[model samples]
Target: MLIWERPEPSARASLSPLSRDRIVRAAIKLADADGLQAVSLRKVAAVLDAGPMRLYRYVDTKEELLDLMVDAVYGEIPAPPPEGDDWRAEVRSLVRGIRGAALRHEWFADLLGGRPHLGPAALGHLDATLTALRSAPGIGDDPDALMRALQAVNGYVLGAVRHEIVELRAERASGLTEHQWQAAAGPYLARAFAAGRYPALAHVVGNGSHQDPAEMFDAGLDVLLTGIAAGA
Candidate 1:
């Protein structure tokens, strides 16, 4: 059974006021202000103005706490569109909502899929996606096809968001904007291109338009959605 489904102890119900919700919230607050690494039972307890032992009443391990934190963030994702007639549009909307949530929680990309997330919010998000895919004109009741469509969109979002997060962290570490960093590295790239080793890389790097991250993400999403439609 999922952690949330486990029965709570009745003996200590009146003795302790802590609940899973409060523990999860405290952990999320710590993660938001600091980072995932800053979150611990001790720290969370301190945030709640309680002792570390008090937290043990709600959560047993740090991994469980992290799972709860992940679910809490998933709870922020917007629900799938109600119409659901346009599968592509619904998938696009859902994927973008997840991306936005990841952007807001910088640490989210690192901990995603760290464990099986069977929480109510996580299940709700998955069910919504399945409903949208099933509603697609050609998909119908084919489980395999529905899974493939879901994975295609979900995988793209995860990979894209992870790449974005890495680039963002790199920029922050270097203390330079993306353009500034590219300009600084231009001479090295020019030298490499001049060596005539990577013709394809040289062509794209030299001729490609400097599109913003969002535009590039949208373009890629469109390509994936088109492929799914064709397969459907």
Candidate 2:
């Protein structure tokens, strides 16, 4: 049974009043403030003003707590429209919501895909994605095709968001804007380009306009959706 499904034991009424939701929220708060490494049963209990052993009544282990935390954040993502929403647009919205969540909880990207998320909130998000895919105008009832398209979009979002979070963390750590960092590295890149080992990269890097991260993400999503349409 999922952690949320298990009933809280009645014997723990004498201890600090705690539920799985409270513990999960406390953990998320700790993670958001200090990253995933800062989160632990002891730390969360302290945050709740309870003993470490009191938390075991709600969650058995730290890993289970992490799972709950991930799902709780997933619950924050907006659900797709019930009617008249284009599949491609829904996919875009879904991914953007995930990106926003990752930005809000910097530690979220680390735990994503770390384990199966059977929690109700995570399963609801998955169901919403599948519902949109199935409702696509051209996508018939081929489960295999639907699964492939879902996987492709999911794979792209995970990779893109992971890179974004890494760069964001680096920027935070270095206290340098992306443009400043690029400018600092410009001379080294110029030297490498002058060596002429990669003409195509040199040409693009030298001449191409810098695209904002959102634009890049949208462009990739457009390409992915186009490919899915063609295949459909």
On lDDT, the leading prediction is 2
Candidate 1 local Cα displacement, residue 138, angstroms: 3.4
Q: Which regions of candidate 1 deviate over 4 angstroms?
A: 7-17, 114-116
Residue 191: error of model 2 in Å?
A: 2.8
| Per-residue lDDT over 1-232 for candidate 1, one digit per residue giving the tens place of the 0 to 100 score | 5568776544344343677788888888888778899999999988777779877767789988988888898899988666636877777777787788888988888886534478788888888788877876567899999889888877888899999989998998999999999899999989989999789999999899969988898889999988877788
- Tell me how many clashing residue pairs each candidate has: 0, 0
Model 2 off-target regions past 4 Å? 10-16, 82-85
Which window of ten consecutive residues has the lowest lDDT sum in model 1? 8-17
- C-alpha positional error of residue 90 in candidate 2 after TM-score superposition, expressed in Å: 0.9
- Would you estimate the TM-scores of all the predictions? 0.89, 0.92
lDDT of 2: 0.86
Question: Residue 186 error for model 2, in Å?
Answer: 0.8
Candidate lDDT scores, in order, read: 0.82, 0.86
